[model samples]
Target: MIAFLKKRAKMSFLLLLKVLRFYWLLLNVWHFSRTKISYEAVKWRNISIYFHFKSKIIKYLTSNILSKINISLNSSNKNFSSYIK
Candidate 1:
């Protein structure tokens, strides 16, 4: 029983070490990046910047169309489930 407990204890210690190592790696990468921005976040940020710039061209046209259509600005998409994958 004592030997089995020692083996279990050693396994638990090794698992804890592995988890700490993984966390340390993530922290090291975050520190190196200095902004905590992951690859996907950077990609999305670039896309948002592009879209914002493009929106300026349509801003006037959309406003005129909206006024003519008389659509309420407060209305939202009630079928939220369609947005989920």
Candidate 2:
């Protein structure tokens, strides 16, 4: 899994965000359509899922960004050392 991500390192971050949004929307639709939904239950569920989804997106995007930044910085340092020699 990590290897696959490393291979596709050039994919745009916006695309990943769009994919996550799509999945979240699908889940939200499913939750809204539940036959057992009540006013209070729906409100509670919406609040919980909203926070859960927001946190997951933030965590994922930030992790990806940090990983990419680390990789880029490491590569630049390596190149700088080679250039100095």
Candidate 3:
């Protein structure tokens, strides 16, 4: 299994990633059936977790970038004033 992927990876990295994703999804489906769990439950949990992680990262980055922009603007304003005088 790993050896097959390694061979495909040498041919194309994108194809290798697709193969891995499909393999994992097949594994999850097999587990879900054995456990008699609702697929919707797993799907919901996965979607929520992905969204929560993305939102947190975006919010943190936005705040950081905004702060940096504000600092740059304030410094430039001071320089402009010195030039005018």
Candidate 4:
């Protein structure tokens, strides 16, 4: 009886860890998705002064396009899923 309880406790702990890991992964992906501009800036930070300015411009353009695309895709996905349901 005690051994069975111990096994159940260990299984639950493992399941809890799995759930936490899944949530951690999702949060990491969300954080990365929101860091596009910062990523570009950091990428060019140590390279050169000239490229740093270029990176800022590229980052701004990229983030803008990405946000617009994300919005459109979300709207489209919602519409498509609505049809399916």
The full ranking of all candidates by TM-score, starting with the best, is 3, 2, 4, 1
Query: Each model's TM-score?
Result: 0.40, 0.52, 0.60, 0.43
Candidate 3 residue lDDT tens string, 1-85 = 9999898777797778789989978987987989878999778866898799999999999999999999999999999999999
Against the true structure, candidate 2 reaches a TM-score of: 0.52
Q: Encode model 2's per-residue lDDT on 1-85: one tens digit a residue.
A: 9988976764767679889989976876677787756557766777998899999999999999999999999999999999999
Model 3 scores a C-alpha lDDT of 0.90
Please list the residue runs of candidate 2 whose C-alpha ends up more than 4 Å from where it truly belongs after superposition.
1-38
Instruction: Output the TM-score of candidate 3.
Output: 0.60
Q: Model 1, range 1-85, lDDT digits (tens) per residue?
A: 9999999999999999999979966865675599866777766765887799889768978988888666443333434445653
* Model 4 spans with C-alpha error above 4 angstroms: 37-85
Error of 3 at 17 (Å): 4.8
lDDT, candidate 1, residue 8?
100
Q: Which is the leading candidate under lDDT? A: 3
Error of 4 at 27 (Å): 0.3
Per-residue CA lDDT of candidate 4, range 1-85, in tens? 9999999999999999999979965865666678754655543543576587889999999999999999999999999999999
lDDT of 4 at 8: 100
Structure candidate 2, residue pairs in collision: none
